[model samples]
Target chain A: MNDEKTYALKSKRIKWFENPLISEDKVYWKPKRAIWFWLAVLSFAAAFGVNVFIAPLQETQILPYRIFLASAVFLLLSLHAAALRNPFLRAKLYHYCQFIFALGIFLSVWDLLTDKTSVLPVPYFPSAASVLQVMVLDHALILKSALYSLRLFFAGFLTGIVLGVSSGILIGWARQWDYWLSPIIKVSGIIPPVVWIPLALSILPGSFSTGVFLIFAASWFPVASMTANGISSTPKKYFEAAQTFGAQKKYLLFKVAVPHAMPNIFMGILTAAAFSFTTLIVSEMIGAKAGLGFYINWAKAWGAYSKMYAAIVIIALEFSVILLIIGIFRRRVLRWQKGIVK
Target chain B: MTEVLIDIKNVNRIYRDDAGHKIYALRNVNLQILRGEIISFIGPSGCGKTTLLRLLAGLDKPQSGSLSIEGKIIDKPHFERGFIFQQPALFPWNTVEENISAPLKARKIYAENKHKAARYISMMGLAGFEKSYPHELSGGMAQRAAIARALLSEPKVLLLDEPLGALDAFKRSELQNNLIEIWQKTKTTMALVTHDVDEAVYLSSRIAVMTSRPGKISKIINVELGQNRDRNDDGFIALRKEILKELRLASISPQPEYNI
Candidate 1:
């Protein structure tokens, strides 16, 4: 036989483990079994150890902290086991762990109600009950503040996007524009929006406008910079190709430059959203009488720690939702870019 | 059939580096390409085959002398010329149909001749993938789409700069055959720059052999094969041998003076 034919025959005859052609599913638990099993064992051991250590610390003799610790351990173990050959077994294990954590929370809550004495029940631990009390008791105030903050955030972010992308395109395409605009933008970008709070206070008519201005300032630079970078790096091949196609100036910008620079534009939007949120909060704290940031600050001054924490939590939740929506938008727009890893 | 389409007269390109050293990309290059002729440029790497093709396409200007297309002095790229590069260069956001329609749409001919614009989609063998994006395609398929986009412009002349150089061997040959068939049917004036000697000889009516480093046209050999030339024929082998000998000789020659 020829050398290539012999080599092929030898390869085919080799064990499945030795064969690079063999699928990952075929090997199953043979390779990752030991690691999975050890992870399961160590995680469960850690959970049980934590439970034993934390059983005596609480005055009411509740083991809630221990239960949560154990819950984490079992969750980790279940995930590890799920990654193994049998997913059914992994699901069953995770379900059982969830049940154990629920039981732990239940037992601890019961202990607190029966063993402790206070007018406002379960006042200390800042559990789900306290979070619920803060929201339900001050429902009208909290709702109003949240709405106001959201409005400010959206206003600033939208304004930032429009200003940033337009200016970025201008700067990106024209060298003279870039040279002229870059330093002014740089100097302004470094001056914090919070520092602008006093300036906004002096000139702005309303506190809400001040907050919006702060958000716009914070968000604008990143969007502009990212968009500029995107346009500048617009592939020379596409530019030349479009030109050869007799694409006029407008068509070239809209068809070639815009789409090629979209990922960076999306990145700019994301960065802008993040900056807007952070800046909005700072502006509200320093200048505005309304918004989640002001609400938290107000609650803290009155030593309403639970209300302060609740307001903080609401802000976090709002940010998460906005980020999720943006993520969905990004995925939909850039669907073609899926399966490509940097 | 022998009507001249592009006349490149004594073209010279000289660039000065940041350190003030002169780099000559092309020098005293004169060539006339006939309408509906499939011409190939073949040379070692860094030869000015691509630069010459670009000049012909009106994408670049020669420092001295002039290029005329259809007896008009070419200052800028016109609707009559189209360029395809090794990269597919398809817009990621646009579908295959949209990419193909871009040239037509850009020229404001899309509204009146929508069906005509869409015809190139099938012509390029991307019929079913009209709505498909560039990133969704394999490398070969994307390059095919690029070819479709270029052909959609209905340019009199198509300039291809190693368009099939990125594909694997099988795909490369497949595209090569398809491109030749397309050229034969469409009869568009073409100037293809490629490093592969066999490819240049296979596709072109005339192969312009070029020298390496500050490239000069060494020779322009006329290929005498029939329209449907057999690759394994005695003539093909003999021509390949002659061209190979010329290339071998071209490689060993000392640097020619860059006369502006």
Candidate 2:
């Protein structure tokens, strides 16, 4: 097993530059000389080269040349950092470089289309510089909207999680509860939360509560259903064993069943998070005054395409950061399942 | 004779098979387990050894009879009867120490008896592995942890259902010795269900050979070879062969069938 692990590790080593003349055992694959690293560096360089030498077709054009240059340099310095000696960091860097290469190519293409040739429709496909400029100019507005969205999103998301998981456990544990609540959940959970918008708007006093309700409804079903499934699927032997040890009902529910169902609960949370985000945007678009969704809609209505695109970029980053945080929480809680799972 | 710690009177456990036929897991099972004595139930796969063990643990109820421990009718599980499952059913989320302390904590006595966790950990030879989770431990180590957990509650009778069945021969023998040592130290009445005839001969004062399909105790043999018993001794080997023959005969006996 040790030999096999070494063989697998060796096979994965980055072999970019090596002396073929050297003995087989002596030749080690080093990340510093990796072909992907060099290719990524060259792509950044090419993007800068194109931006600096070729002037924009439009006189008013402002390219984000400095940002691109800075990013490239940071990537180069990070690739050489001592931290890359750690296998996990090295693997991340390898993947990050590939992403950077793709991004560089995408930016170069966009720059060519928008600033140089003007082949694509103007204003709709804004230059990256214009989007960045709008981001800087409207920083306060964007920040306020982001904070607003976050407030509404989290308020709904947390409530959904708490109620969903608790009720799920109860329903799964008790057969009588399952008989009554299962049908309600099955019927109501199927209808998309957005469909309740009309009813929610009329019933709730304000748009904020309605928006929170929509997000809550959207997030609740996945968590509740998955958590129930997880709890119900826990092996019967565990319950029996716990019973034999004189464990009471409370201990059986929380200590035994809940811990066993953690992996599945986390999976439910992931799905719920995705749903909440989608619902958050839609809810804000319909009735909210100050949020990312509202800002994007407001920008589009006013024909400020660059600002709209900038808001969209912010939303994407926000969503990914939320997901990353959840992933970290899962790793911590389900630490025992680490090697067994992934 | 020692006092009867457990009395099983006309105990009959019924179950429904996959084909929707009512089968007798245990039929007219009457036995008295003496206090501070080790008893082994040996039989084939479908025999009611495990069913009997479960009844002793009060995890299951008999259909038409009663099981009593020390004059009290046993209907539900209690801390006084520690049960060790075939699989170390250690809670995967908890460490070895936590698993051992679970029953104590459940009974709301852990605060006073917390040190017993450490004592049992070392007793099971899992000194350094107190914080290790179930998955981290090897199969034998996990089973030992399970045994320690069961023992921590300090039950009067320890019921084992093929506890060492999953272990390799080397680990099984080592654990068998550990079991004996624990039994001597604690003097807890033990009722172990297993299929290994040699294990029965080595561990028990009496071996109850059971038959399947309307499972019944066909024979009960008294092992007169005293405490300092040797597996290699002619006496031990002879008893082991005798029990093995009884188990073989029990297996080949005509099985009663229930018509659907």
Candidate 3:
């Protein structure tokens, strides 16, 4: 049937019949490189063209926007050139083209509407350039604030994870510990970490430390509860199996129970992270001297909406970066759960 | 072979149903496990072969009487009795080598016995799979690693609770051969709880057949087929048939207490 004569003789040809190209061995032709690079460059070029030709309704920093668009176009071109070396990256760029094109069109519309005409209000709906200006011009201050926030986050998160895991292990294993501590964990976990601001301010000595405590409180409960839940739900057979191995309580907790609860503990951490980040921002806005939260508040008071938007963008960037790192770590730690994990 | 390693005398385990009726998981069970001999407990489901195995493993307590090893009362589980569960039950986070070496590390004797893990790894035919996780392995290979892990600890008595119940027939028979070879090499006394009559006859030296509902041993058949028994042989088939007939009788016996 593979030969053309046999294929012709057959009343109903197979799906691949009448095709000139035949693969002796099963293999596929290489997929063509995606055209995202050209689209991205063209899109950015269009946005840049709109920025240059259009006149603003009021005097605003248009230079930064122009430079940003130009650089974006240049970067896209360079990336396209670089992608020639990496086949995987070429595929990813193809996937990104539509989004990039859409974003470029959106930016052009925004620039024309905000800068060219006061369609959405002059001060309230700042153009993309003004927001980018804050990120580019005030980068040093923004970076400093980010550093302070990250320091607080790490301090709180590490403490919370350490204390949470330990307490969870204790509660899950010991009936007495579960009896005493579970109620407190349940009660305190329900209350928002922001509610502790007043109490933390009064006792914690400084706003920065209070911020840390607030973040810690935010993270600790979910982690602890999840760990406890994970350990508690571990199959009784695991304990019995380990017991037959003369496994001590420590070994049982770590080797048997802890490993079993790991997925749950990870779930808890993800929940805790969402809560912790929100807690950090709120606490910083309330009391901290140098942080993105404080910067956001300061920008709001001065009616610098663009800078406020810039701070939020920075916050989002930080969050995305942290999430990316965590995702990588989780993938590695839970690599054993390759096929089945939801 | 004559020396007794574990003795179970008049052991009883009872559970209360929701309606407050007493369900006898095991009742007045008596058996002696001999040193360096592979003894199997074969019965129908709910016949407490596993319950009896667990008693020997010290994973459960008998309501009455005692379980002892070398004249020492077994009130709690110890490494002296390595228990292989129905499932391989290997730690998912660990690699094959890591799971095998877990026992040595748990005892804080890793420095001295770390080499034993590598030896058992190859002995169990798990040479290239040292770095592979349990989830990555097939059913037979994972069980092989589980067996290797248990054997690494060098227990006086190994308790197996239907360790081959999950595999396909081909894999099951393959592991059966592996088990016989391992037993011969280690000379570690083993107590297997199984429902498969062929498995019981092929692997064990003595078969303790039991009945359900107030589970107790109904008959004990000595399988002296010697080492390297051929499954197609007349003697092997005879013993298998005899055990099957005994099981048929055991299952059909009505509960005397249930009778009005």
Candidate 4:
């Protein structure tokens, strides 16, 4: 009995930090040693070594300093990982270390190709160090263009989502409204909003307004279409039940229909967000004097390939961050669907 | 004669099927519900039992006829006439307590009657699950929550459309007792639709047998058994058998055609 009790207690012990390969019950993928620790150490060594041993073809401000700072940061992060008791954190740190090591190798190769060999042509493919240097020098210009793009993108996206959702609710709830509006939406929604750029530039007072209009037109149709489908497909029984509770037309439309269509509305908004970015870029490329798209164009005209690459990198990072924020919001709002979905 | 709480006169509801053929969901159906009485409409599928209930709830209008509560025409839904659908129909976004308080909130009387929401939650035996959402609750619990929601408004008449049909036998019997307890305490008039003959005989004071294909009521049987009725008792079984026989007959008999 004592032996059985001991076995039961041992089995019941909580293993908060799960090591998949080391666990007694089952074995899966896990390394014998801390993979992240070694990767982090190797990355720090490589970056510091490259900065000290290799000479750049073109000197740039802050290149060596940035590499030193990055190596120190990685060393500190690896030390922090070593002290963590949680396996999940350790696993995540390991993946991040692997990414950094891969990035360091790629950068080293690119630096060698541009500086020491003629494998990559000059004037077109600048060294990574030069790109970083250009980014540091043109920080103010990049910030200004990013701000301009954000302003136009947000203004148009907000207007489009608000109008799309409202009109969708109206169309979904009332038959007469659907009859009059659906046809108009179908015809107008199909034409790409950017196609009207020439006409818009001619009619609008400035490029700013034209850019905002293009984004709004690009984002509005998907949001409206998805919202309408969501509302129309809401179970009729819910409406009937609400009606029997003496709900008015407004109450049924707003309370019963809108909440039911939230998931679909969120999906529409996500689609609209993606579309708005594409439209914003195209609109900026057409005539905008200040924006990321315009900055790229300006850099290309001046044959400043390093600045162009830096701007492209900034845009990619900003777009990914926006998408991540939207994804988090979607998860929070639709928490009820967690267990129901896979 | 007890005071007539709901009066239905010569009601008919017609619909066009998917093939564009005219179908009579209800044909000249008429029934009177007394104040503080339990009435059950029992029939096969597509027999207008639900149609008549919807008309009483004022969810749909009947052509060439009318229904009234307290001598007032019911052209639209009123809080006095509550409805519980076949499915729980609880809002997926709302917790159990919130769903129960919906009717009061809808009528804009939630502030004054807020305390009553807790009482109804306990009354339905859903005390600990007030915070649970509809998807988390079992079918029986969700149905109970729906009942609490409908009753919180203090409706004079509660119309139930197969509210417990989806529950298992054990849960169905448990909810039947809950229903009896509720009716006894509140003395609220109830109209239930069910395919179960035993359920009809167990809870209702009178059972209305309906025929399909231009649905119409064939007979009304008054259950003489009093309160605290035992399901195992000989008289209860007899009433169940009689109602089942009547339903079987109602389904087999030829329906009369109406000239267009």
Candidate 5:
């Protein structure tokens, strides 16, 4: 009846080429409550049942109703929100419902083998229940270690990024700086930071500083190289265009070179973050008194395999959260890259 | 009597190819651009039309001779000479307003010329797209923004290297009119390099036809179609035919040795 409605109908008609049979809207309708959410709830309920009803063949640590209560609360909340399309986590829950179901299935199978039956060997492969219990029981030490690791990682990673980017930009822009500095960087970059443990520990005054040193080394090389590459690889056209408008060296560097090299710099930071984490764990394992890596080593020495597994899980979660933050920050900064990147 | 805006004399630009062979990008090129005139260098590819444009913009240096504007030697690029490339070359990060106003900021004269950016944006019909990024614009729109950017600087001469080559026919005609309007308003010297004979005829006061392989100007034709050129007019069609013939002549090389 209206112009917009006619245009919409015409556009929809154009979609006939994509699928001749199902170009109509009614064919693509989805239900109010997703089937996957209920399936996840059912799967989690089954795991809860296995944990409660069946007794273990051999004695293993099982926190009375922690898992049961948590699952019950989670299921109740999920069930309550299933029908509604409220803004908070509705889409996320629906999307990851299948993954949640698979996790429950995995936990159920793991429990049956290790705790409920004596088929698998003990200590080496602890039941999921024991691992979860260790996380709760050793919460104090775990929390302290996680805090220490965070401080060290942040100190090392931030320092490395700042220095790496500054020097990289210098080297990329000025030929003299590249000639003078890149050789040393290239040499240091070739050697892995893990190998510098003995040397760095000897040179640095303390273990914490040495840990910082190694992590800084791990992050520096990739950031520098990627930043330099990004800066240097900026098309000559950009420079020429800017120069015609009376842009001097400083303006050109800040405006044209820096903006163009941003995607590459972000690439470098991502790589550096990953590498720094690797070095963080290694440095902690070797000498540090408190960290996730240290916790892992400490648990292994005491034959507390469950604590070691718990520490590893915490490390993954911590690292993932840090990466998620970086990802969000980068997406906001590079919002202009939407159509260009694609 | 119009004064000479740019005096280009016997300029040569030589570039070395991969095997260390000397290649002539341009050779012995001479042209004098007059003030407030639209002049075009029209030829086939590799005729060094772009190379000549770059030389005028001071983006590239000549191996011999020199280029100067108003008796001042053009050694480096300056705001006095604005250049437009085939690609818009708008910064991907900056919005339309930012792109157009970037020159003012770059020159550290933003306070004085800040108002001109808004005027130019409206002039180019990019008023609503001030916040939109260059990637968000169509090819023609981006190029228009680029034109506005160059014009905001108020250059003495505007060198265009196939600025409308990438646009579709409709967009090209639309932009051609936009260019004509801008030219009429500013009266800036426009030196365009294009292969499109119709575009050359429709826009420029004079067309310099060039030959390839060590490029040189073969002929310069005065349009004489007067103002508001109708492409279908008898005189306009005849002039277009005359220029096309010159271009054909420029493309063919005379080799007496091959004559039977």
Candidate 6:
């Protein structure tokens, strides 16, 4: 069956574009078959080269850097092609990338575990056992740092939403308030939230409070700005309709404006969360005594490069988890907004 | 003669530009609309047809005019007057049911009245699609939903501003009959603004032909045909010809040019 065509407006002309860029319906399989054949051949060559040939050279402890480089190039090429044209292909490629990335991570860990090349390998062949011993010993510190950072992020993020939404409604509904407050809001939003760390520490109770304050500051601007813009742009007809019905101002705000402005408010919150993650790290480095950022700094100071790498990896994983949850919520809240062209 | 429901007299509206140049959108306008009369306002674009409708709906104010409804001066929009615009301005985020019930909900129309008010959902032929959102509906369906929403409030006077002007020919014909049927059933006063002379002739009891920009009432023709008028009849044809000639005359006649 032919794919359904969707119409898009470009200037005065409306043109139909086909969706589902790839499907099982297509007759051409030449490119897919060719790519699969090369993948099979390359896997065999790498397997034979590492296990049969280079197993003996492990007294010198091989790094498998060539395997890493070759696999990375193949994966990147396939992923870029899949994502550029086809949604189904892009989903499949993303899953494959995740699997490949996981496998690469496992191989890197195995290499480090079995090899005898120390990070500080100048005149010393430090064994892999020593590197493993340090990680096992610092496990508790890593867990504590991760939890501390997450706690700060949630505290500041929630507070930012409360302040942003209330202030946004005021600015949006009242012209006098908008005129008076807009310049201040603009000037203050421009100053990076992280710059307030030292000031927060002096005014707040503790180090964690400073990090939380940073999170709040980082998230507040986008939500407030978006809420204000959304409310102001509500169709005048709806407002007038409400007036004809004798709807009170309170009813107008709660019943009409809030729900209408929700999408933009959610967008603001999403951006705030992203900015909070980045600022949380910076704030931890400046003020907090414990966090993922502090652990990385501590590892770096003591020259434990492997531990530093692992901590950074954990931070990335946490951010990914938060992003996934936010994405799911976004889909649910915006379900009604589907099928509308911007 | 019918009961006078709306009365406007000596209405003058002056608009000032950024450089303080004066423009008269309406001048010395007078009109009286009866309880069950269907009135049509026909004029060129920007002849203040829309402005007059807005004023009737209490959405705008006239600089020097007296407007009364049932002999009471109207200063604010009462729920007694309902409006439908050319564009179906249904809220995009709400379903058809929610949009139609909006004014009802605002008035706190009891849960009991909801079932009665909801009868218009099917009366307007949107029964199965009540749950559908505005974006999902066709242009005709969307406009129908808007009309349903306006009627749900049960306004005594309906001010329709080119309500079917945006629809395709087929949809427009279907809706015009439906509008006539609704008008005959409810006997509500309606003032419709449209540029389509044929629509004005078909729907209106009396067609008030408006002159070009800064419009004045040029002629008000009383259509003498029966309620269910025949389109192919000679009498109907003669009335249509006379209107066309008058419209052409208004367009070509060389006369003294005022700012109007």
The residue-by-residue lDDT of candidate 5 on A94-191, one tens digit each, is 55667777877887788889888856888888888888888888899999999999999999998899988998999999999999989989999989
Candidate 1 off by > 4 Å: A1-127, B17-19, B256-260
Candidate 5 chain A: worst-modelled 10 consecutive residues by lDDT: A16-25
lDDT at B249, model 2: 84
Question: Which ranges of candidate 3 are over 4 A from the true structure?
Answer: A1-36
Pairwise lDDT winner, candidates 3 and 6: 3
Off by over 4 Å in 5: A1-34, A56-76, A79-83, A86-92, B16-24, B254-260
User: Model 5's CAPRI class?
Assistant: medium
Decoy 6 TM-score against native: 0.81
Q: Candidates' TM-scores? A: 0.81, 0.91, 0.91, 0.90, 0.89, 0.81
Worst 10 residues of 4 chain A by lDDT: A19-28
lDDT value, residue A71 of candidate 2: 77
Could you give candidate 6's per-residue lDDT for residues A1-342 as a string of tens digits? 232322211222521112333334253322332354345434434432443343331343223444444655566676657655554454455435444545545544444434422244422322233233434567688778888888888898889888888888889889998998788789879999977877898999998888778888888888888899888888887777766655667767877888788888888888888889999998887787899988878777877666776677679888898888888987777766888834
DockQ metric, candidate 6? 0.48
The candidates, ranked best first by lDDT, are 3, 5, 2, 4, 1, 6
Clashing pairs in 3: none
On the 0 to 100 scale, the lDDT of residue B174 in model 6 is: 91
Give the CAPRI rating of model 3: medium
**C-alpha RMSD values across all candidates:** 7.9, 4.1, 5.7, 4.1, 4.7, 7.3
DockQ of 4: 0.64
**Candidate 3 chain B lDDT trough over 10 residues, lowest sum:** B251-260
The Cα RMSD in angstroms, rounded to one decimal, for candidate 6 relative to the true structure is 7.3
Candidate 6, B58-136: lDDT as tens digits:
8889899878898888777767888888888787778899888887777787475778556888988899998888999
